[model samples]
Each structure stands twice: as C-alpha cells, then as structure tokens.
Target: MPTYAIGDLQGCYLELRALLDRLAFDPQVDRLWFVGDLVNRGPDSLKVLRFVHDLGEAALVVLGNHDLHLLALAAGNSRHAKKSTLEAVLRAPDRDELLHWLRHRPLLHHDPERNFTLIHAGLPPQWDLAEAQVRAGELEAVLRGTDYQDFLRDLYGNQPDRWSPDLTGLKRLRFITNCLTRLRFCKPDGTLALTEKGSLENHTVGLVPWFRAAGRKTRSDRIIFGHWSTLGYRQEDNVWAIDSGCLWGGALTAIRLDATSLIPIQLNCKGYLAPGQD
Candidate 1:
C-alpha cells in the first residue's frame, strides 16, 4: 500500500478535495499521513475536520499548534488576542465528539517499519528519536488527561526558550509543545526563536532552521513535518517538509512516503488568505 504524507490543510477543504482527486487516492488501499494544522485560518474548518475524522483508519495525524489552539478555544481558554476562524467548528452539533477526537491525536508519530517519523513541527536538537518519543508521550498524557483544561489555559507562552533535562511542571510541557508544533528557527545552542516566521534567508543572524542546528540528535532519522509554510517543501538533511503554503495561494503538496525517493505531487491552490493576512 502506498502512503502519501500531505502538508498542513489549514481549513482549505476545497483544495484538499482537489488534491485527493489529483492523487487518485484510494482509501481502501492507500494510506494518508496529515502533518496537522487541519483547521483554522481559512474557510470550511468544520468540513475539513469532519472529512478527516470520517477517514477513520485511512488517515494519520499529528497535532499542530493551530489544532491545539482550537482545542484551547473549545475548552474556553480564549486568551489569544487575535480571533480565530474556528467558529464553524465550535458551533457544530457534533462539536464535543469532534473535539474529543482531536484531543486524542498524537503529538508525534513514528513508524519504525518505514523508518520515518511524522510531527507537526520540528524537534529540539537535544532530543534524539528515543527522547523525542518520551517527551511526546509526556505531553500527550497531559492533553488527554482530566487536567487538560488547566494545561490548555497555561499553554500559551514563549519562556524557557531552551530545553533542559531538569525542566519540570508547566514550563517543561510548554517547551515540549512549542518545539513539536510551533518551532521554526533556533539559535545554534538550541534556543527557540518562536517569533520568527520568515523564509530561510530572512531569518535573524545566528539563528538556523531547527533541523540545521548543530549537533541535532535526530539528524540521522528520516523526519517529515509541516507548520512552516514559508519554508515550503524541503528535503535536505534527511528532513521532508511538505507544507507548500496551501493557504497562501501556493500549492497543496503531497509526497509518496512508500517510495525510496520522495515523489511530490502538488495542486495549485485558489488561496483563501493572502500573504500577510494572518
């Protein structure tokens, strides 16, 4: 069975449907891996969520920052100043069931058989594959546990910009969440520059894309991620980035994960949001 890993959906349901048509995807035989951000920032977030949820076992998803934000909003943790485009989903009749399903999604997915790992964003340099999995599990437990609402309420922060083995409590969880779903650039010493959202060349001096940070422990692992649409599709240093800015009038990209060499297929999108709009 062929498995195709797709970039962030970001509520672009029409483009997602068109991309699937282009791939001639057969849910019965082929598998799909979605690099999260399945909702918010575009039209039809409700439809997008329902469609992916209906896919059942055919789809695999890792939670993105936007997805977590949706969960937080649903839980009444509306501390964000900017309004989100998730009202449709929040008002749906099956909202509780949908949110339940979303909350249970993993922070990281690793398939040893395929020798590939999937995440919504980049991993910290200090975490090798084993450590990454452990940290993901720790955060996942909190997200799915009874105290999830408390965690959600305290989840928004940029502190503890670096990782440490001694880190504990909410700070530790926040750092793990940021690295897995919101990270882009980091200093050579692995301190996150979470505010930088520009293209590779436009990054601040001494800051490098997370995968390029010196002594990155996951350098030898085959990793697939989304969440950096500005960085777009990249396949350098054993990392595969498929988020081709589908929400920004760029292409919606998918790469065949079953192939030895990455084969990308993209559909030009009729964008819902222009650059600089979000």
Candidate 2:
C-alpha cells in the first residue's frame, strides 16, 4: 500500500483524476493525504468535493484557506473577496453533508510512525510538532463546535500575527489559523506575513520562508504542505512544498510519501485562471 500526498486542488478535479491515473492509484490499496484547498477557482469544485468526501478512510486532509472560506460562506459568515467557483458546491443538494464533513477536518496532521507532518500552508518557527498539534486543536475545537459561525465571522484578520503562549480567545485562534493556512514568510521571531503571496526570492529582506526561519523546532521532522503556489515545488530543508498552481496554469502534483525517494508525479493543467487571480 502506498500513501501519496497531493497538492492544493483548488477545484481542478480533472487534473486530480489525471494525476491519479498517472499514479495508477487504487483506492483499496492506496491512501491519499491531501494538503487542502480541495475546492475553489476551478471548473469542478462540486465534483471534487463529492469525490474526495466519498473516499472515506482512504483520504486524510487538512483544511486550507480556500476550504475554510467555503465553509464560512456556507455558514453565512463571510463573503467571497473576488472571483469564486464555490457557489455550485454551496447550492448542491448534498451541500449540508459535504460542508459538515469539511468543517470537521483538522488544520494539521502528523503521522508519528512515518514522522511526517502535513499542513496546508506553513508553520511558525516557534512551535515544535507537539505545540503545533495543540494549537491546531485549539482552533479545530472552535471550528468544529457549535460556535463555528462566530469564529468564522472573525476569521479574516491579520492581528496577533505573532504567536505567543500568553495569547488567548479569538486572537489566539486567529493567529493560529493564519499560520496554519495562510503563512508563507515570516521574520525570524515568527511574525507571520500573511499578505506576502510572492515567492521567497522576490527581493524581500528580513523575511524568510517559514521553513527557513532560524531555530525552527520542527526542522528535524519532515513536513509536507501546499498553499504556496507561487513558491512552486520545494523539497528542501526537511519540508516539501507541493502546491504547483494548478488553477493558475501550473501542474497538479502528488508525491509518494512512504517511498524512500521523492519524485513528484505531475499532470499539466489548463489555464483555468491566470496567476495572481487567487
């Protein structure tokens, strides 16, 4: 049995299927770990959600920013900022069931036996695998609980960008949320730069990709993450970044995680949306 970690789908259902075909994947004997953003901005978000949801125990997932945005929209707590391809999913007859399943997904996943931690975006330098899991649980409790709508309403902020053991309430939740789903770069002290969507080499000073931050606690553990399409495919510094901007004319990628070597299986994508659209 093989377990593959896939990149952000962003509703590119056909590309996902194509990539799977290239892998010769069999759900009965193979498992999948999705790095989130399973829907948004592509042609077949509803189909993608339905397909992944029906996979049951064969698929494990962490929630991405777009996935959370869809949930927030379903909860009537947030509006789509620009273009959104999630309306069909929201209006589907099985919308409630699908959204319910999605809402319960975690922000982080760590396979202790394999020693691989999976997240949608990036982790702050401050946390080790243990603290990361705990903080993720804190936010997960709110999103999966009855007060989910209230938290969703307050989800779209950049305050409390720096993580602290002293942080509490919504502020704490928001900071954790940003780091897990939207983080790309940060200062050495783990101050998150949520707005910096460009690549790390874009002449930015004093800000490094989260994995490159000094004294990162999880530096010794392998991490597989997506959500940084602009950063492209990276497998350095004990971290693997698999988001290849499939919705933005890049390729959809999947890496076999349990294998001793890393060679990404890629499927070229149609330019459904231009770069920077997201």
Candidate 3:
C-alpha cells in the first residue's frame, strides 16, 4: 500500500529501473506517481514510454514540457524541432498507442485524501488548489479532446505571462499549460518568468521561484513537483522539488509519499547529455 513520487525521467529508463529497485518498489501493490518527462533527451524514450504506459493503474503520471513536446512533434506541429531522442519513439510500432496514452495524461494530479498534489512543474502564485485544479482540468480536457491537434499547434509560447480570471480560449489553455508544466520563477504579482531556467542560486533578480512566492495561494498545501533538475531535491516551504538532474549525470530521486517523514531515495545516473545539450 505504499506510494512513491518520482522525479523526471527524461528517457533514463535504466536509471528509473535502478531507482525503483532501490526503493524496493512493488508494482503488484505499491504505486508510483511520476512527475513526468517520461520521454525524450536520453537513450530510451520508446522503452520508457512503453514501460510506464504498460503500468496501467499502478502508475500516475502528470505531463511535463518534454512530454508535450513529444506529443506536438507527433501531431506534426514540430516543423523545427532540434535534434531529439524521441525519434525512436516516433518510429516504434506502438507509436500511436504510446502517444495516445501520453496525450491522455493530466497536467495535475491531486490526491485529496493524502492532501498531496503532483505537478510536473511550478504553479503561479495566484492559484490556490481549487483554482489550479480547475485550470488544470480545462487544459486536460483540451489535450484529451478531439481538437487536440489544434491545441498542440499553438501550444508553444510564453505569452500572457500573467493569470487573469477572465482569460479564455487558446491563451487560457496555454497559460495553464505553462504554469503546470513549464513554470519556474515568477514575480510577486504572478507574472511568469517562463524563460528562467537557471537554478535558484543563479535565477534572475526581481523574481522568486513560484513555490517561494510570499503570496502563493498554495503555500500551505503539500506539493510534489519536478522539471527543475537544477533545483535538485529540495523540501522547503511545503513543496518538494525532486528533479535532481537525472539526465545530466545527477541522480534520479524519489520520495515516499506515504511515509511519516520525508526521505529522498536516489540512484546515481551515468552521465548522459551534458548541460545545454538539449
């Protein structure tokens, strides 16, 4: 009955398995909550996708930016994507099945009973759990809907860098997608710094990490998120930052969600892509 929350797996399938084994993970009973980036940037995107997709109900995955990029590329929206490891996945016999399952994954997964919310990235300071859940649902509906191709076509952007209750249409969905999957630092007033990819020690001035925003609505809530591998595995201000740069020769981290105390278990990764390689 144990449950664990794992960090980004940017196609590090071997590392994922090693970490799982280190956790003594039992698929027959224990469950896994993935922070996403299940594919791309490493040597095993197709294998990673298939392994997680085959897990069925035993695994819960939130969509990450890389995951969405893979989807967009598959949707024919990637007219200019850079060199990517996702080619293996796209050429696989089960490509459609893998992509479909990935497409259906949510941007946010909240377990009300456990009072723990899982997101692939940061949340804007303006959104409380309720608001975040609603916005997440809206985006999820679009991604899982029939017109998803259209949404994918227009998904890449950093516009409308602020949240407004009146936002609608593509901008609204895109904003939601960004916060839930790509956010890192943002202003006090919830102005997003989507391009800020540096670690906390080197982030630009005037903006704070979303989890550190003084006015953050979900500050009192427990959040488990990845995406900022540079941020490493940190637990502070009631948020867990677990993407410990597994794809960059760091570690694949995991926390026991059902534990009485927070303890991170990690598996060292053999250096894959170097920094800035992606």
* Predicted structure with the largest lDDT when compared to the true one: 1
Model 2 lDDT per residue over 1-278, tens place: 79999999988888899999999989999999999999988899999999999999999999999999998787775556455778899889999999999999999999988889999998898899999999999999998899899889777888988888999888999999999999998986888977877786783688888999999999998999999988888889789999998989988989998888889988888869888664
Question: What's the TM-score of every candidate structure?
Answer: 0.98, 0.97, 0.98
Residue by residue across 78-158, what tens digits does model 1's lDDT show? 887366999889889999999999999999999999999999999989999999999999999999999999999888999
Ranking by lDDT: 1, 3, 2
lDDT of 3: 0.90
C-alpha lDDT values of all predictions:
0.93, 0.89, 0.90
| Whole-model alpha-carbon lDDT for candidate 1 | 0.93
- Looking at model 3, residue 232 earns an lDDT score of 92
Off by over 4 Å in 1: none
